[model samples]
Target: MLRKALLTGCTGFVGHPLLARLSNCDFSVVACSRVAMPALPASATNVLVSGIDGLTDWQVALAGVEVVIHSAARVHVMNDQSSDPLAEFRKVNVEGTLNLARQAAEAGVRRFIFISSIKVNGEGTPLGSPYRADAQPQPADPYGVSKMEAEQGLRALAAETGMEVVIIRPTLVYGPGVKANFLSMMRWLHKGVPLPFGAIHNQRSLVALDNLVDLIVTCIDHPAAANQTFLVSDGEDLSTTELLRRMATALGKPARLLPVPSWLLEAGASILGKKALSQRLCGSLQVDISKTRELLGWTPPLSVDAALRKTAAHFLEHRTH
Candidate 1:
C-alpha cells in the first residue's frame, strides 16, 4: 500500500533533489514541472503543466495523489524593473499556489506541504535575535508579501476544507546546482579573489539541501506537522567573513579578505545601486528552529561546513574551465 505524492517544481533547485530522494521512499511520486525536465527517476511519474496560476488545472495529475508538496513559486528576480512587482508575485505565488491547493483538496489530497521563505519573517534580524515561527510577519519585499499571503490563504483553505497544511519557511538554501549570490561567492573563493567582508560580523542562518529535503520527507507523514508553520535552518549560524573563509578552505585557497568598513561597503554599494546585495552580505538574519526541532524532534542532518564543502566540490567539478 504505497502512499501517492504529487510534487510541483520537479526541475527546480530544491525540487530536483527532492524528486530523486522521494523516488526512493516508500511512497509513489508524481513529479510535476512547468518546463522541460531531464529523465526522471524510474519509480516516479512525470507530468507537465502550464505555469502555476489560478487557471492552471491539475485534475488528472492530482488523481489518487494523497500528498502534495508545493515547491514551485516565482523566486527572487535580480533586476525586477517591473511596474508592479507585488502584482506579478501575487499572480503566481498567491493565486497559483491557492489554485493548486484548492484543486488538491477537492481531489481528496490529505496533506499539503508548502515551501516558503524566511523573508516572510522580515528581511534581517538584530544580532542574537533570531526569528521565531510565531513572530509577527513583516514581509518587506513584494516576494515575501506574496508568500505570506499564500500562507494565509492555505491556512484559511485548510480550516474550510479540513485538509492538512504544513508550511516550512527556510533561509537561504545552497547545494549543487545553486545559482546567484551563493554560486558567485563560491566562484570568487575558488579563484582566491579578495572580498571586502572581513569587517562585517553578522549571524545568518542557512539550510542545506539535504537538511531541507530530510525535513520535507519527515513532514510527509508526521502527524504533528499537520497545519503547522515552522521556521527551519541549520542550527549553526555564521558571518559573511566566516562563510567566505570556510568556502576558501574548502576550495584549497587562502581567505583573501580585506578589512573594509561595513559603512564604507554599504555606501559604495548604495552608490552602485546594489544596496540589497550589501545588506545580505553585512546583515544578520538568524532563524530559531526550536519549534521545528521540539515539535517534530527533527534536526539538520548536515553541518554548515560539510554542506559548504559539498557545494564547493560540486562547483569545482562542474564549472566550465
Candidate 2:
C-alpha cells in the first residue's frame, strides 16, 4: 500500500517542487494549499484549507496520512504593518504548526518533517566558521524566534506521542519560480544592471530547491532520520561576486559589478534604513552539512553552477513571453 503524505503550502515556491518530487516517490500526496493550484498533478489530492491557524480543520487532509511535511508559515514581509510582529508570527508559525503536528500524531502519522529556516541557527556566521546542526539557536528576528519555539514544541510533542520528528534547516533556496532576493538578483543580472557586490568576500551557503526536496523525501522513510535536526546545503559555498558572475554568465550577459567598498555599502544602507538588507548582501552565512551527510548518507545531487544555470535559463525563457 502506498503511504499517504500530507503536504502544507503546496502552492508556495518550495512546496510546488516538493509536491512534484513526491509524485515520483512511493507516497500518495495530499497537497494542502490556501488557494487553488489547478496545475498540480492529477495524482495529488488538493485540499483548500481556510487557514493554518489553531482553529483550522485538517481532519480531511490528515486522514490516513503516514507522513506530514509542514512548510507553510508566516514568512517575513517587508514593511510589515502588524502591531506586534512577534505575536502575529507566533500565532501562525508556532501555534498553527503545533496544532497540525498534534492532529497528525492523533491520526497516527508515522513521521513529521518540519521545514525550518537557517535563521533559526542565527542571522549569520563568522568568517571561515559554518553553523552546525547542534549549534545553540539564536533566533534574531520574529520569524526566526517563532521557528525556534515551534521546533522546541515539536520535540516535546514527539517525546510524548512517539511520532518520529525530523527537522531540516535550509539556507537560501533558489530554483525555477524562485522569488524575492534570488529572483531580484537574476533580473538585475539579466538586464545588465551594475551591482556593487564585487568587493564582498564573505562566503555564503545556499541550497537548490531540488536538493532540499530530495532530502525531505529521504527523511520520510529513513529510520536514521528520526528525531534528528539537520543543516542542509549544496555542499558548496560561494562569495557574492562569484555568485553574481556565474548567474550573469548563465544568462549570457556580462557581470556588471562595481568594486565598491563593503564599508561604504553599509554606511549607505544605514542612511537609507536598510542595514539588515546590506548585512545580508555582504555578510557570511555558511552552514556545515557534514552531520546531515554522515547521518543520512546523502549528498546534494545538483551542483551550484548547474542550479544557477537552470534558474537563469528559466528566468530568461519566461521573461520573453
Candidate 3:
C-alpha cells in the first residue's frame, strides 16, 4: 500500500530536496510547481510541474492526492525597488495558496502542509524575545502579511471542511542552492570582504535547509502535527559575529570583520534608508522550537556547522570563475 502525496512548490529550495529524499520512502510523490523545475530521475517517481492558475478543473491533480505540502510563497526583500510589491506578494502568497488548499480539501485531501515564514510572527527586527506561533500576527510587509492571512484562511477552511492544516514557520533557512543574504555572505567571506556585523550581539535562529525538509516530512506522517502550528529552527542560536566566523571557516577564508559602534551604524543606515539591511544583521530574532521537538521527537539531522559547510561547498564548486 503506497501512500500518494501531492507537493506544491516543488521548484522551491526546500521542495527539491524534499522530493528527492521522499523517493526512498514508502510514498510515491506527485510534485506541483508553477514554473518548470528540474525533473526527478527515473529511480524516483519523477516530479510533474503544473500551472495552478491555468487549471480549468482542480480534479486533475487533486484526486487521490493524500498529503498536500504547500511550499510556494512570494518571498522578496523589502524596498527591493523591483516591482509591484503588494500585488506580487498577494497573487502567490494569498490567493494562490487558498486556491490550492480549497481544491485539495474539496477533493478530500487529508492534510494541508503550509510552508509559512517566521516573518508572519514579526517582520524586520523583533523587539526583544522571539515571536512564537502563539503570538498575534503583526506582519509588517506585504509578504509577511500575506502569509499570516493565508494561515488564518487555511485554518478557517480546515475548520469548515474538517480537513487537517499543518502550519510550519521556519526562520532564515540556509543550505545548498541558497541565494540572497546567505549566498552573499558566502561570497564576501570567500573574498575576505570586511563586514560591520561583528559588534552586534543579537541572537537569530536559523534553519538548515535539510533540517527544515526533514521536519516537513516528519510532520507529514506525525499524528500530532495535524491541525497544529509549529515554529521550527536549528534549535541553536547564533550571533552575527559567530555566524560570520563559521561562514568564513566554511569558505576557508579569514573572518573579515570590523568592530563599529552599533548606534553609529544604525544612524548611517537610517539616513541612507538601508534600514532593512541594518535590522536584518542586528535583529534579535529567536524561536524556541522545543514544542516541535517534544511533540514529534524531531531533531535536526544536520548541525549548523555541517549545514553551512555543505552550502559553502556547493557555492564554491559552481561559483563564477
Candidate 4:
C-alpha cells in the first residue's frame, strides 16, 4: 500500500531533499510550504500554507496523510537580533509544532516524525562520555528549549490521541549544497589557507544529509520508532584536526595546520568576543547512536569521507563559475 505523507518545510535544507526522497520512494506526498515551490516531483502535490504559527491551518494538507514529517522549525541563528529570542522561537517551534500535530492527530494521521537538534542534549559532552538517546535534555539555547517543549507536548498528545510520534535529534548535518560553517571550512580548505587547529582534539559527531534523510524515512514506518527519541550521527566521531585533514584529503589539498595551543586560541577568541565560535570549533559534542542502530537496525549509508568529497566537489563546481 502506498502511504500518503505530509511534509512541512518542503523548501528547507533538509525538507527539499526529503520531499524528493519521499516522492522517489513512491509515497504520495503533500509538499507543504509557505510559498509556491517549483520543480517538485510528480508524486508530490504542493500545498501552500502561509507561515507556521499557532493559527496556521493544516487541515487541507493533512487529508488522508498517514505520516507527517514535520521538519519546519525556528532554527538557530548565530547572532539573533530579536528582542525576545525565546518567545520568538516558542511561537514557531513550540506552538506552531503542537498546533500542527494536534490537527494532524484530529485528521487521523497515524505517525508524526519531528526533526529536532542535538542542542537539546546540551552544548557539549565530555570527551569519552557521549550523550545517549535517553539522556536528560538540557537545552542551552532558545531553539533547543523550543524543540524540547515541542517534544514534551507531542508526547503528551501521543498518549492522549494514540498518534505515534517519532523524534530524531541530529547533530550538525552536512552534504552537497551545505552552507554556513561547513561551507566556510570547505572554502578555506579549497584555498589552502593554513589553520591553527592542529592541536585541538575535540570530537564532534555529524550526520550527512543523505544519512539523516534515510533515518527519517526509516522512522516513517518502523514499528520500533513509535513514541521513541533517537540521536543520529555518522557513528564516527572526528577531532577538529582529523576533520580538517579528511576534508583536505577530499579536496586534494595539503592540510597546512599549525600546532597552536588550544588555550591560546580560546584566549584570543575571548578577547575578540568569538568565544562561542571558538568553542564550536574546539569543543567535544558526541552522541551515541547505538540505540538508534540497535532498535532500527540502521547505519549511515554514506561515509564521512564520501560525503566530504561530494561537498568539496559541489563547492569547487560552484566556486569556479
Candidate 5:
C-alpha cells in the first residue's frame, strides 16, 4: 500500500519541490495550502485549509495520512511592522504547528516532520566550534524563538502520543527562487559590481534546496530518523570571499572584489545601523552534520559549486523575463 502523506505549505519554495518529489515516489501526497497552486501533479491531491492557526481544522486533511510534513509557518522578515512580532510568530509557527501535530497524532499519523531554521540554534557561531545537533537553542529573534518553541511542543507531543517527530534545522538555503541576502549577492555578482568582501575570512554553512529536500525525503521512511533532530548543510564551509568567487565563476564573470578590513566594514555598518547585515556578511555560522551523516548515513548529493552554478543559471535565465 502506498503511504499517505499530508504536506502543508505546498506553495512554498521548499514545500513545492517536496510535493513534486513525494508525488513521484511511493507516497500519495495531499498538498495542503491556504490557496490553490498552479500545475499540481496529477498523482497528488489538493486540499485547501482556511489558514494555519490555533483554530484551524485539519481533520479532513489528516484522514489517512501516515506522515505529516508541516512547513507552513510565519517566516522571518527583515523589518517586521507588527506591533507584537513574537505574538504573531507564536500564533502561527508555534500554536498553529502544534495544533496540526495534535490532529495528526489523533488521526494516527506515524511521523511529523518539521522544517525548522538554523536561527533556532543562534544567530552566529564561533570560528572553530560549529553547532551540533545537541547544542542548546539560543534563538535570537522572534521567528527563531517560535521555531524553537514549536520543536519543543512537537517533542512533547510525540512523547505523549507515541507519534514520531523528526526535526530538521537547515542552514541558509539557496537555489532557484532564492531571495534576500543570497539574491542580493547574485545580483551584485551578475552586474559585475566590485564587492568589498575580499579580505573577510568568516566561514558559513549553507544547504542547497535539492540537498535539503533530499534529506527530508530520506527522513520520511528512515527508521532511525524518528524523534531525531538533525542539522543539515552542504558539508563544505565557505567564507564570504570564497562564496562570491564561486558565484562569479558560476555566473561566468570576473570576481571584482576589493580587499577591505572586516573591522572597518563593520564599523561603517554600525554607523549606518546596518550592523545585522554586516554581521551576516562578515561573521561565521557553521553547523556540523556529522550526526546526520553517521545516524542516517546520508550525504548531500549536490556539491556547493554545482548548486551555486544551478542558482546562477536560474538567475541568468530569468533575469530578462
Candidate 6:
C-alpha cells in the first residue's frame, strides 16, 4: 500500500539522516517546516509533496498525510532565557505538536510519531539508577517539562481522536552534523586537553544517529509501537570518564583525564558556580531500552564505538574540507 507521511522538523539532525532511510520506504513524504530548507529531493509522485510552514498552515499538506513524524523541539542549553521558557518551548513543541496532531487526526493520519527526549524521565541520572520507560517523568528544565507536557498532550489528543501515537525517547544522540554538548565534547577531545571527568564512574546511555533513525523506522513498522513510549539507546552504557576515553580513541587522541576526587570536583564546581555541570559530568545517567528491544525485536546496527568513530571522522573531514 502507498502510504503518505507528514514530517515536521524536516531540517533537523534526526530528520537529515532519516530522509536517507525513508528514500527506500513505501512512503510518499510531505514535509512541513517553519524555517527554509537548504535543499530537498525534487518533489515527485514518489516524494509526492513537500512544503514549509508554521503549524497553523499545515492543513493543506496534512489533508492526505497517513502519518506524522513530530521531531521539532526547542532543546536545552545553559543560561538560555526566553521571556517565557515554558511557553516558548510549548509554542513549538507543545502547541505546535498538538496543532499537527489534530490536523493529522482530522486528515485520518494513522499514526502520530513524537520524538521525545529522555529528559522526560528526569534532568539527570541518580548515582546508581538508570531511567526506564516506566519511570514517572520528573522533568527539571523548561525544555524537559515542555516535552513531558507535550507527551501528555499528544497522548490526550490521540485518545480523543483514536489516532495511534508512538512516542520515542532517545538519549544523548550523537553523530555527524551533531551539535550542542556532543559537539562540545568532540572539540574538547580534539584539543588533546586533560579533563576532570576521570573522577566520574556513572554509566549514561546514548543513542547513535543511525541507531536512533533505525528505531524510528522500526516503530513505523512495529505494531507494538502504537500508543507506547519507548526508551532507545545503543544499549551500551558508559560513564563520563569512559565516554571521554572512547571519544579520544576515536579521534586518535590521548585520553588525558585527571583523576580528581569527586568531592573536590564538586567543591570546585561550587566555586565556579557550576554545580549543575559538576553533577552532570560526575553523575550516572542511563536509559534502559529493553522495552524497545523486546517489543520491537530490534537492536542497534552500530556499536557505540563505531558511532563515535563516524562522528569523529565527520569532524575531521569538516576541518579538512
In the order shown, the candidates' Cα RMSDs to the true structure are: 1.0, 1.1, 2.3, 1.1, 1.0, 2.8
186-251: candidate 6 lDDT, tens digit per residue? 888888778777877777888999999999988886888899999999999988888999999999
Off by over 4 Å in 1: none
**How accurate locally, in lDDT, is each candidate?**
0.92, 0.91, 0.82, 0.93, 0.94, 0.81
**Per-residue C-alpha lDDT of model 1 across residues 1-321, encoded as one tens digit per residue:** 777899998888999999989988977888888766678777788888878899998999999999999999998887799999999999999999999999999999999999999999999999999999989999999999999999999999999999999999989999887998998888887787888888788899999999999999999999999999999888999999988898888888899999999889999999999999888999899999999999999989999889888988899899985
Number of the top-ranking candidate, with lDDT as the measure:
5
Cand. 2 Cα-lDDT: 0.91
Q: In model 2, how large is the Cα lDDT of residue 241?
A: 88
What global local distance difference test value does model 5 have? 0.94
Per-prediction backbone clash count = 0, 0, 0, 0, 0, 0
On lDDT, who's better, 1 or 5?
Answer: 5
Error of 5 at 79 (Å): 2.1
User: What ranges in model 5 sit over 4 Å off?
Assistant: none
User: Which is the winner by TM-score between candidate 5 and candidate 6?
Assistant: 5
User: Which TM-score value belongs to model 6?
Assistant: 0.92
For 1-321, candidate 2 gives per-residue lDDT tens digits of 777899998888898889988987867899998788778775788899988888887888999898999999999988899899999999899999999999999999999999999989999989889999998999999999999999999999999999999999999999988888888888888788899988899899999988999999999989999999999999999989899998888888999999998899989999999999888888899999999999999999999989988888789878853
Q: Which pairs of residues collide in model 3?
A: none
In the range 14-61, model 5's lDDT, one tens digit per residue, is 998899999989888999987777788877889989888999999998
Sliding window of 10 residues with minimal summed lDDT for model 4: 312-321
- TM per candidate comes to 0.98, 0.98, 0.92, 0.98, 0.98, 0.92
For model 4, the superposed segments whose C-alpha errors exceed 4 Å read none
Clashing pairs in 5: none
Residues 135-218, model 3: lDDT tens digits = 788888888888988899999999999889999999999999898888888888888889887788878899999999999999
